[model samples]
Target: MKKIIEGKIWTAVCVALTLLMIVSAIWIGMRYYVSMDIYQTPSMFLEGEYSVDGGEWKSIEKDRYITDHFHKIVFKGKMSKKLLMYFGSLTISSKNVWYTLKTSDGTVIQSYNFDDEKLSYEHTQTDKPLALDMPNTPGYCVKTIYPDYLTKTENITEDSDLIFEVEYPYSYALVSYNDCVDVTAYYNEGMYLRFFYDALPPVLLFVLICFFGLFFFPVASFILGKIDYKYLTFGMLSFLWGLYMIMQQISGYLNLWIVDPTVCMMMDKITGYCFVAAVLFYFKANMSSRGTRIAANIASAAYLSCVFTVFILHLCHIRDLNASSMTMNFATAGSIVIMIVLLCVEMRINRNALFFLLSWVPLLLTVAIDAVDQFIHLPGSHYFNYGLAITMIVQIVRLIGDLRLQYKEAIRHQQMQKELYEAKVSVMTSQIRPHFMYNALTSIAMMCEIDPKIAKEATITFAKYLRGNMDSLKQTGPVPFTQELEHLKKYLYIEKLRFDDLLNIEYDIQATDFVLPLLSVQPLVENAVKHGVGMKEDGGTVRISTRETETAYEVVIEDDGVGFDINEQKDDGRSHVGMENTKKRLHDMCGGEVKIESVVGKGTTVIVILPKEGQPNEDTLS
Candidate 1:
């Protein structure tokens, strides 16, 4: 269970599942807001007459089913004066007046001219075409309620010639004058809700995700990651696309002053192409395959050429949007499908990146649904710009996923650095221990000349001391508690030879099976004898004890000797490197801890705590 829990494959799966849960939660929350109320349409519609010309009310084209691109139809019949009329495109008055309501004899009853931050206009001759106030935002946004709905009193005669023009080739084009205006309002609300969520919040969310506080995080990430990121490109794309969608949703009132739907479609096409191009750039920026790069570059150039060509034709007053739209949809859809396939292939080869590619699944679905909707024309299916907003969200998720991988990589790098440090410290302590070994050997050599029997016994003990130190160096993993204790005992026996009766040792060994880093306890014992005991004329006792507790195993090395002040800004010029190295290795290798306490001229105690279980998961480095 422990192995499975900590395994790499399971860790990745856990992360993916966690992210999916969070995304699902958020999606449910958004669905709640997008469906604040169930808006239902009334069961009836208003009916009115259409005429091709003022003289022929029953002419062949009098039914005036004009729709789609540049359409001019005349509605010159009477209806309920207690009526509500709205245009989804820019409108004109034959009298060179801004929108006006006249009685039967042509006496204007009410007139309105719009020009403000949200709307503006230019009345030339008898044409009333208006532009929006937002910069680089080419469109019309005029929404005016002729008279408050509350002002409706009695029925009277009404007549007007309404012309309609839009960008997207209409799937259904029919002049609709619903006699039941109340039903139209409720019907539109239901339709709009069904199509999409509120555009304002989604747009704002994408903006924040892209910039993350004035582009601080995105800019820093770009520099640190060294990739030609497309966050800004996608952000602009969503911004324009969102505006275009919002205009369509509030068309009757919001954009009645704007010149036709041409502006809306133009904006959509331009940004859509730009968005597709940015995707190509993102692929090139992060890709390694030269062939893929060449292909994406060619595709991007082709898309740019087509978009620019269509834009030039539109600018020159040649307004046909169908051909360009068809081309754009096919090209964009094909490119996205190819990209998705490539990501899937990459994921198969590198399962470590499975979660990373999973982040693009939402974007791929959006592309596929839009492709089928545009090309197949399924009557039973109608998709809105919700996918457009969701695509931006997926990109944000991708960014977050990339950052997560980077964070993990950073943590791995840090672990490697720590291991290297531990090796370096081990080598340092090994060097210092050899100096102590030489001193002990020297003492034995002198004893050999004076007392040959003592020297022989000392030589046998020296072999054990040397063997213990070499064993510690050979095995990087911790040894059993008893094994380490034996090494310490061998070390103390060698030191006792030089100090004879001056060195006294005591043991209160209780722990039996807990594992600890090699040589972790020996150095503390060596320090007690060398620094604490050797400082006094009357040598002291070095007491070593170990106890097993519920959580951890505690080991204490105490010495009754002339101890130095721990906080005194003074040293014995020895550096005390071995004691420090032992403390660090114990804690880092085994989830252990070390603490030291001392009183001047009294005694010193060094306590070590080792976790009483399986080896420490080294990732939890202290």
Candidate 2:
């Protein structure tokens, strides 16, 4: 019945976590998709360039044009035209002298030198005339020449199309131009792609899940410390993957170094290696022999060396940016080899390796997709990264479940141990009870036959001792110092009837602010009577006292009688169950210390020092 309830609770927890992961993934996907859609589309622009004659149209290459002294010029012509005059105008400043035609309208067009600062016209008689540009010269000169030609390209008729050659003197002579529509369009596309590829919605949700999941670690640790197979398995993998993502994000943000790309790629591969290492560690800690654990550690160290080597190569530029892709390849091969070794070991031991083996699938897929993307620049490559993250989360959840189960088993075991210990103490206490009762009854029977009044008194004392025992057993709260003393007095009175004039009892309790363990005082008093006074031939005195110490409340029971040898075993064949039971009860109840000072001729003194309220002094009891 208990198992069923526990199973139901665990099942519910798993279901809830699964639902949360799904909802978070969806939320992240949608937000990323929406943001991506909004930023991907680019705006279009329509601009025209004209030559003196009808020629092929040229569109400006905005990026190059803005930074160089070249402006695009274009026109078209037919084969019938013999010569065409191409007229264009531009301003020449003292800082800017020459102009160059950066791009021609047709692929076959070539350039020839023209006067440095002059605006010129090209004469072409051919049918097809190409477009050309004078670099770094302003359009203000053309406006001045034909003010009304704002929206038109003026064509000077000739036999053929015309072309002009241009050159520039300085590199920085090109003027910068901004087109709002074009810039806006570029930004939209770039931002949309970034948002889409990152999958912001799912990532945000996952972050929250990770944050909340951390709280369960302590609870899981306590309950499943022994059965750490699943906890270590999932915990190690999740930690590796999380670290990998963090490294990727860091590289993405700090991409100024030459080795950044390599580092980023290595980080991804290391994540997989780390996952494998985590699995190996989990198995080692769980079921692997010492030799297997050592081997796993050695293998993990070797893989780490390989990772460091890749990093060094990248930093030193021994391998180009393209060569960074090989890191993943090496890692993948290494992982496969390690996996085989682990599987073989597992097979030999007849242990289940399914979980560890299955964990590698998503990681392998992630590695493959990433490698392909880096080498060939394929589409949908980033989705593999997302897949890896999701896989890691699933693995974490599974690990958490395993941890929970282990925790439950541990708790159950502890409870069972506690019950067994309690039962043992109870049986030991029962042994002491019968012997003490038999002595008290025999004493009372003798008193009844000799003296009626003394017999009545002895009988009452016996009844009071039994009553105190029953009350102490039933009461859960700590007994006050004064009340516990009263119970001790009753028990000692019964013992007095058995020993008659041979026994004398003394008690001096000073500290009464707090309570002590229930029935604790009586047991120690009974021990003093049985062990200290019982061995005396003529007579004995039992002294009981309490005092407040600097750190604890001290209770002392000392008796000077026919002191038995402390080193030798007791002559009475019976067990020392009473003393043992008293020690156990004090340890459990108040966690107080029990000190025994005994000698062959001196006698015995049992000193019990209990801690005051608010202090859990387990050391004293231990």
Candidate 3:
């Protein structure tokens, strides 16, 4: 049992280490993706020439103006320049907007924007237009500009004269003039990538810790079952909950690299629902009854409904790539309500479920903060993700501590059982000595009077058998079959002197390479001679034989005497003391089975089947 427990611990540790390596690999892969050099630059230029107050057309000239604080051009006046170049912010009240920009040589540039403000216009002279149209020209041309990657200047020499126009104001004025342009790209800063990379080590450590926590739970369950300790089920449940949470954290980190926000949101919700279901299932299996089962089924149905609803919304385009806050809020509210209902059911069933249920406290806070953070565009929500990792680790530790206590209790119980068995064996062995000594002494005295020479031989055999019995009492394992047979021979020889001509014995032993419990065969032979042969008026034969069965070593002792009914005789406790002792010794030593078959006035056969040495029985023996 101790070896089994140790093996379990070893396996758990190895699995924990393996999971840690896998998590580390994933973390490294995520870090590598984040660190790759990538950038998205959105550039804009004038699409049409227009002034804020409908001013006259002015010549558009390339001018480089440097500010005192920063070396950058503020503005170059042009009546043909697009309205987007006149202001820093553009707010369109119209349902749609369209504009055109004309260049000096009558080239035109076209641009458009939806309600997405992040893709708003930005002004920069370095970002040249491909084509533009002069306010009154009918031809278009590309603007010349010095390329960043090339040393030469590219000019708008081809197709310089073209006319361009666009209809706008579907709902209201869709186009507006903007002067200042924000020239920023929507890409993560290098420092933010570094932060993500640095998070790998801690995340990997936490995953390893959770795996270790889960690994011990099954072993703890087995030990607890052995000792009948039911409360350890809580420890198992806690570890399972910890594992679910760790899985969620790992999945969340993975989702960051996935560009589809809808899929990411769905994954998050599914993970949360899965965690709740796992906890509820554990509670229902360990603590609650039919009512909890019904409640769990209802919660499960609700979660599935919510998942289906989210999918339908996405499919119908009601929830697009950028879903509105109201849609997300509704989903979150529905999920929380379902989870809260499940929590209430759990509380009604088991108050101790609170420990596991309370783990969601921080998770609930995270969800609320996540909602506000996404709306207000704030940071620190990632810290809540980290907080979840910490809570999972704490729960894992608590589970481990609980399992350790159960293991200790199991070990204690095993020790008590072993002690009780030893005590019973000792008492039974003590009962055999006095009666056996008296019978042997009486036989030797009678032999001495009748035959002096045979008496001396009988006394020597008696001495040897006694010595074997003494050694058997001290040892706790099977004796060699050869040694047991030799003891039986000595006992039969001593008994022969008592029976004289009335007793006839025969040995039909088969070749064997096995062992049995000490004195196992001798006691049965002694019982046959005393009870079976002694009751017959005519001389009877006692036969001892050893043979091999398909599965085990078989020893048979039979006597032809006034055979009693085996069933009626076995229940006579006082008469069957030797039979009981033989049974107990076989059980403790070789884990063999003893069977006695008899018929009144026919004969009695006692067969002992012992497993081959060094091999276990087909079934659990003890």
- Which lDDT values do the candidates have, in the order given? 0.54, 0.51, 0.52
**Residue 411, candidate 3: alpha-carbon lDDT:** 79
Q: 419-464 in candidate 2: lDDT tens per residue?
A: 4355345633652467777877888788788998998987887777
lDDT per residue as tens, model 1, 1-622: 2233235434544654665566555656777765444432222112343343233443223222222112222333443333344311112211101233344456443333232222234232324343222222223233222322313542332443222111211233221222101122222433344334444344444433333423432443453445434444444444444444444344333333345334544554565566566665555444445565576667667767777887776665554443346666677766766655554555545563355456556666665684565444443332435555565566655665665566466555556546636654564355346677788889899999999999999899788767665555557567677787887787788788888899999999886667787777877887799879988899989999999788888999999988878888775576666566676677667778898899988989999998766554434332
Per-prediction TM-score: 0.42, 0.41, 0.38
Clashes of each: 7, 30, 28
C-alpha RMSD for every candidate: 16.5, 19.0, 18.0
Lowest lDDT sum, 10 consecutive residues, model 3, at: 64-73
Residue by residue across 1-622, what tens digits does model 3's lDDT show?
8778867767776877787788778777776675344322122222223222234443322231111111111222222222222222222111112333334554433233232231221323333232221121111111111122111122322223323223232221112211112121123342223335554455456555544444456555664565322334444444545545544434333322433323444444445545544544443443355665676556556655665665566556554312332444465466556556665767776776677667657756776675555345453335455556556555566566766776787777677556435643553464346776687789888878889898898888788866765665465556567777887787777667667888999989894567666666776776788778888898689999889877788999999877887556255445555557568667656678898888888878999988765444435342
Runs in model 2 deviating more than 4 A are 1-37, 41-198, 209-219, 225-230, 243-287, 316-328, 358-401, 437-622
- Most lDDT-accurate candidate: 1
Work out how many backbone clashes candidate 3 has: 28
Q: Residue 311 lDDT in model 2?
A: 57
Candidate 1 Cα lDDT to native: 0.54
> Which residue pairs overlap in candidate 1's backbone?
46-178, 46-179, 46-180, 47-179, 81-156, 140-258, 143-253
